[model samples]
Target chain A: MIALLMRDLRLAMRAGGGFGLGLAFFLIVVTLVPFGVGPETGLLARIAPGILWLGALLACLLSLDRILALDWEDGSLDLLATSPLPLEGIVTMKALAHWITTGLPLVIASPLFAVLMSLPGAGYAPLVLSLLLGTPALSVIGTFGAALTVGIKRGGLLLSLLVLPLYVPTLIFGAEMARRGAEGADTTTPMLMLAGISAGVIALLPFASAAVLRVNLR
Target chain B: MELEVSELSVARGGIPVLEGLNFRLAAGHALILRGPNGIGKTTVLRTIAGLQPPLAGRISLDRETMTYAAHADGLKATLTVEENLSFWAAVFGTGGIDAALDGFALRDLRARPAGALSAGQKRRLGLARLLVTGRPVWVLDEPTVSLDVEAVAMFVRAVRAHLAGGGMALMATHIDLGLDEAAVLDVGPFRARAAQEDHFDEVFL
Candidate 1:
C-alpha cells in the first residue's frame, strides 16, 4: 500500500501529473470571489466561509479523476488488482494519497485564501479546522465516484454529477461550522458532525469503491 | 504446482463468448492459446488470471497465483524504466530488479523515463515487469506485439527461463514463441453461438 501511495505522490510531482492543478484552481476561484461580489467587506466576510468551502470542495473534485483514470487507462489498475494487495487497501491508499496531495495543501492554503475574501478574524481557526476535518471526507467520497466512473470514456462530467450530491452533507456541516465560527457562535455541533461524516466515510467507503472497481474491471 | 481449468466458460459485456473450455498448465511448462481475432482468447486468459469472474466452471489457481500482461503495458509515462520496475518489485515484495533490467536489456536505459523509450523499448520494459512480479504463473496476451526480431528473441528467452525455473505461462498469440515444450489450445472449438442473448440479463435489453 505504501508503494502505491508513494508512486501516486511521485507521479503527481512529475510533469503533467496535475499535482499543482487543484491548488491553482483553488487560488483562482477564491481570488475571483471578491471581484464578483464587489468590495463590500461585510458581504465578503459573510459569504467567505461558504465560498472557500465550495472552492476547496470543487478543487478537490477537479483532480479526483486522476486518482484512478491514468492507472485504469494504462492498465495499471488491472495489474494492481492481481497483486497480493487487497482492493480495499488499494482504494484507501488512493484516498489517502489524494488527501495528502490535494486536500492537505488546500488546508494549508485556506488561511491565505480566507484573507482574500475579507473573512472575519475570528473565522480563520474554525475555517481551517473545518476544512482539515471535512476535506478528507471529500477525497474519500470522490475516490468512490472516481472508481465508479473509471471505465467510462470522458466520464468527468458524470463523475461530478454523481459525487456532488454526496458532498452535500459534508458541505453543510463544514460551511456551517466555518460560518458559526465567523459569527462567534457555538461550533461544537457542526464540528462534531463534520468529523463524524469524515470518519464514517473513511471507514466504510473503501469497500464500496473497491466493489465498484471490480465490476468495472469485469 | 499445476494450473487447471475444467468446463470453463467466460463472457464479455453479459454475453457468453466461450464455453466448455478445458486446459491444464503445470509448473515448468507453457500453454499457447490460438484462435482468430474476436475469438475470446483474451477473455479466457483474463478469466483464468482472475481479473473477471468466470461465467461458469472452475479454475484451480487462486487470483494471486498468476500475473497478467496485455496490450496496455501498465506503465507510467512520467516514471523512468528503473522506477517503474522498482515500484512493482516493491508492491510484490519480490526484491531487486537488476535481473529484470538485464534480462530485458533495459540496464542501459534504466534512467530514461518510460515515455522516452521507443515502442519496442517500452514493450521490453513492460515484459521486464513479469520478472519482478515473481509469481508462479505468467498469463500474457500477444506479448510480442510491435517487437522486432531481436526483442521477440528476448521475450522467447525470458519465457524459456521462466518455464525452466518451474514457472508456468498461458499466452494468446498468433506468432510462434518457439517454445517446443509448450502445448497449444485452440479456442475456435469453444466459441459460443452468435446469440448475444445467452446470458440471463438478455431479457433487460
Candidate 2:
C-alpha cells in the first residue's frame, strides 16, 4: 500500500505540473470572480465562502481521472489487480494519494484564496477546516467516478458529470459552515455534518471504487 | 505446483470467445498457447490468471501463485529503469531488483527514465518485470513483440532459467521459442461456436 502511494506521488511529481496546475486553475478562477462580479468588496465577501468552496472542489476534480486513467492506460491496474494486494487496498491507496497530491494543497491554499474574496477573519479557520474535512470525501467519490469511466476514451467530461452531483453534500455543508463562520454565527452543525459525510465516505466508498474497477478490468 | 484448467470457458465483451478449454502446466515446465490473432488465446490466458471470471469450469491453481504480463508494458515513462523495477519488486514483496536488472541486461540503462529507452529496450524492461514477481506461474501474452534476435534470445534464456528454477510459464505467442521443455496447446478448436449458439447461452444468462 505504501509502495503504491509512493509511486503515485512520484508519478504526479514527475508528470510535470502536478498539483501546481490545479492550484493555478483555482487561483485563476477565484481571481476572475471579483472582476466578473464587480469590485464590490461587500458582495465579494458575501459570496466568498461558496466561491472558495467551489474553487477548491473544482481544483480537486481537476486530477481525479489521473488517479486511475494513467494506471489503466499503462496496464498497471491490471498488474496490480493480479498482485497479492486486494483491489480495495489499491483503491484506498489511490484515493489517499489523490488527496495528498491535490486535496492537501488546495486545503493549504484556501486561506490565500479566501483573502482574495475579502472573507472575514473568523471564517479562515472554518474555511480551512471544512475543506480539510470535505476534500477527502471528494477524492474518494471521485475515485469511484474515475474507476467507472477508466476504460472510456476521453472520459474526463463524463468523470466530472458523475462526480459533481456527489460533491453537492460536501460542498453545501462546507460552504455553509464557512458562510456562517464569516457571519459570526454558530458553525457546529455544518461542521459536524461535513465531518460525518467525510468519515462515512472514507470508510466505505473504496469498496464501490474497487468493485467498479473490477468490472472495468473484466 | 501445477496449473490445471478443465472445461474452462471465457469471453470477450459478453460474447463467449473460448469454451471447453483444458490444459495443465506443472512446475518446472512451460505451456505455449497457439492460435491466430483474435482466436481468444489472450482470453484464456487472462482467465487462468484470474484477471476475469471464467464462464464455466475451473483453474486449479491459486491466483497468488502466478504473475501476468500482457501486451502493454505497464511501465511508467517518467520512472528510471531501476525505479520501475524496484516499484514492482516492492509491490510483489520481493527483496531486490538486482536479478531482474541483470536478467534483462538493464544495468546500463538503470538510471535512465523508461521513456528514454528505445522500443526494444522498453520491451525488455517490460519483460524483466516478471523476474521480480517471485511467483511460479508466469502468464504472458505475446511476450516478445518488439524484440530483436538477441533480445528474443535473452527472453528465451530467461524462460529456460525460470523453468530450471522450478517455475512454470503459460504464454500466448506465435513464435517458435525453441524450448524443448514446452508443450503447445492449440486453441483454434476451442473457439466458441457461431453467433446462433452464443445467443442461446446469452438467453440463459
Candidate 3:
C-alpha cells in the first residue's frame, strides 16, 4: 500500500504531474472573484465563505477524472485488480493519494486565497479548519465518481455531474461553519457535521468505489 | 499447481460472447488461444484471470496465483523503466527487478522514461512485468502485438524458461509464438450463438 501511494505521488510530481494545476485553478478563481463582484471589501468579505467554498469545490472537480483514468487507460487498473492487494484497499489508497496531491494543496492554499476575498479575521481559521476536515470527503466522493466513469470516453464532464451533487452536505456545513466563525456566532454544530460527513465517507465509500471499478474494468 | 476452467461462459455488454469453454493447464505447461479479431479471445483470458465473473461456469485456481498481462502495457509514461518495474515488484511483494530488466533486455533503457521507448520496447516492458509478479500462472492477452522478430524471440524464450521452472502460461494471440509441445485452443468453436436472448434485466440491476 505504501508502495502504491509513493508511486502515485512520484508520478504526480513529474512532468505533466497535475500537482499544481488544482492550486493554480483555485488561485485563478479566487483572484478573479473580486474583479467580477467589484473591489468592495465588505461585499467580498460577506460572500467570501461561499465564494471560497465554491472555488475549492470546482478545483476539486477539475482533477477528479485524473484519479482513475490514467491507470485505466494504461491498463494498470487490470493488473491492480489481479494483484494480491484487495480492490477496496487499492481504492482507499488512490483516494488518499488524491487527497495528498489535490486536497492537501487546496487546504494549504485556501488561507492565501481567502485574503483576496477580504475574508473576515475569524474566517481564516475556520476556512482552513473546515477545508482540512472537508476535503477528504471531496476526494473520496470524487474517487467513487472516477471509478464509475473510468471506462467511458471523455468522462470529465460526467464526473462533475456525478460528484457535485454528493459534495452538497460537505460544502453546506463547511461554508456554514466558516460563515458563523466569521460572524462570531456558534460554529460547533456545522463543524461537527462537516467532520461527520468526512468520517462516514472515509469509512464506507471505498467499497462502493471498488465495486464500481470492478464493473468498469470488466 | 493446476488451472482448470470448466464450462466457462463470458459476456460483453450483457450478450454472451464466448460460451461452454473448458481447459486445464498443469504446472510447466502453456496454452495458446487463437482466433480472428473480435472472437472473444481477450474476454476468455480476462475471465480466467478473475477480473470479471464468468456468466456461468467455474474457473478454479489457487487464490492470487495468476498474473494477467493485457493488450496495453500498463507503463506510466513519465516514470523511468526501473521505476515502473520496481513499483510492480513492490506491489507483488517481490524482491528485485534485476531479473525482469535483464530478461526483457531493458537494462540499457532503465533510466529512460517509458514514453521515450518505442512500441516494441514498451511491450517488452509490459511483458517483463509478469516475471516480477512471482505468480505461477500467467494469463496474457495478445502479449506480442507490436514486437519485432527479435523481441518476439525474446518473449518466446522467457515463456520457455518460465515453463521449465514450473510456471504456466495461457496466451491469446494471432501470431505464432514458436512454443513446441504447447496446446493450442482455437476459440472459434467457443463463440457464443448470436440468437441467444438478452439478459437486460439482470445487467441493469
Candidate 4:
C-alpha cells in the first residue's frame, strides 16, 4: 500500500501539467473573486472564508474525474483489481495520494491565498485546520463518482454533476465554521460536524469505491 | 491437484453468455477453451478468476480456489515494469522481486514503464505477473493474443514448463497452443448447463 501511494504521488507530480493546472485553477478562482465583487476590502474580508471554501471545493471537483479515469483508460485499474491487495486498500491509497497532491497543497496554500481577499489573521488557523480535516472526505467521496464514470467515454462534466450534489453537506459544514472563525465567533459546533463527515467518509468510502469499480469493470 | 467448475452460468447485459458449464483440470494438465467471439470463453475464465461471480456455480481448485488474468493485463502504467510486478509479488508474498524479474527475462526492462512496452511485450509482461503470483491455477484469457510467432512459441514453452512443474492452466485461445497431450474443451457446441457426464475431453488431433 505504501508502494501504491508512492507510485500515485510520483505520477501526479511527474504529470507536469495536471498538478500545476489544479493549483492554478485554485489560485485563479481565489484571485478572480475579488475582481467580481468590486475589490471592497471590508466585503472581501467578510466573505474570505466562504470564497476560499468554495474555490477549494471547485478545485477539488475539477480533478476528481481525472483520479480514476486515467488509470482506467490506460488499463492500470484492471491490474489493481487483480492484485492480491483488496480493492478497498487500492482505493484508499489512491485517495490518499490525491489528497496529498491536490488537497494538502490547497490547505497549505490557503492562508497565503486567503490574504488575496483580505482575510483577517484570526481566521487563518481554523480555515487551514478545517480544510485539513475535510478535503480527504472530498477525495474519498469523489472516488465513487470516478468509479461510476470510469467506463463512460465523455464523463468529465457528468462526474462533476454526480459528485457536487454529494459534496453539499461537507461544503455547508466546512464553509460555515470557516465563516464563523473569520468573524471571530465560536465555531466548535460546525467544525466538529465537519470533522465527523471526514471521519465517516474515511471509514466507509473506500469499500464503496471498490465495489463500484468492480461492477463497472465487470 | 484439481480445479473444478460446477454448473457455472453467466449473463452479459441480461443475455445468457455462458450457462451452467462444468469442467475440471488436474495438475500437470491443460484445458484449451475454444469458442467464437460473443460466446463466453472469456467470461468463464473471468468467473473462475473471481473477478465476476458465476450467476450460478462454484469454482474450486485443489481443495482451494484460484486466481485469474483477464485480457486487460491489469498493470499500473505510471510505475516502472518492475514496480508493477513487485507490487503484485508483495501482495501475493510469493517469490522475491529478483527471482520474478529473472524468471520473466524482464531484468533489462525493469526501469521501463509498462506504458512503453509494445503489445507483444505487454502480453509477456502480463503473463510475467501471473508467473510471479506463484498461484496453483492459471486462468488466462487469450494468453497469446498480442504476441508474435516467436513470443507465442515462448508462451507455449512457458505453459508446458509450468504444467510440468505441477501448475494447472485453463486458457482460452483460438490458435493451437502446441500441447502434446492437452485436452480441448469445445465450449461452442457445449451449452452452459451441460451435465458432467456430457463433457468430452478430446485431443486436438
DockQ of each model against the real complex?
0.80, 0.78, 0.79, 0.36
lDDT, candidate 3, B11-46, per-residue tens: 876778889899999999999999888778888888
- Sorted on DockQ, best first, the list reads 1, 3, 2, 4
The pairs that clash in candidate 1 are none
Tens digits of lDDT, candidate 2, B67-166: 9999989999999999999999999999899999999899999999998999999999999999999988899999999899899999999999999999
Q: Which stretches of candidate 3 lie above 4 Å from their native place? A: B195-205
Best candidate according to DockQ:
1
In model 3, residue pairs whose N, Cα or C atoms come closer than 3 Å (at least 3 residues apart or on different chains), thus clashing, are: none
**Tens digit per residue, CA lDDT, model 2, A68-155:** 9888898888999999999999999999998998888889999999989999998999899998989999999999999999989999
Question: Judged by lDDT against the true structure, how good is candidate 4?
Answer: 0.81
Q: Over 4 Å off in model 4, which ranges?
A: B62-65, B191-205
lDDT, candidate 3, at A45: 95
Q: What is the lDDT ranking, best to worst?
A: 1, 3, 2, 4
Model 1: docking quality category: high
Off-target runs (Cα >4 Å) in candidate 1 are: B194-205
Predictions in order: lDDT: 0.93, 0.91, 0.91, 0.81
Task: Give the worst 10-residue stretch by lDDT in candidate 4 chain A.
Answer: A13-22
lDDT of 2 at B155: 96
Instruction: Compose the digit string of candidate 3's lDDT tens values, residues A103-212.
Output: 99999999988889999988889889999999999999999999999989999999999888999999999999989988888899999999999999999999999998
* Candidate 1 global lDDT: 0.93
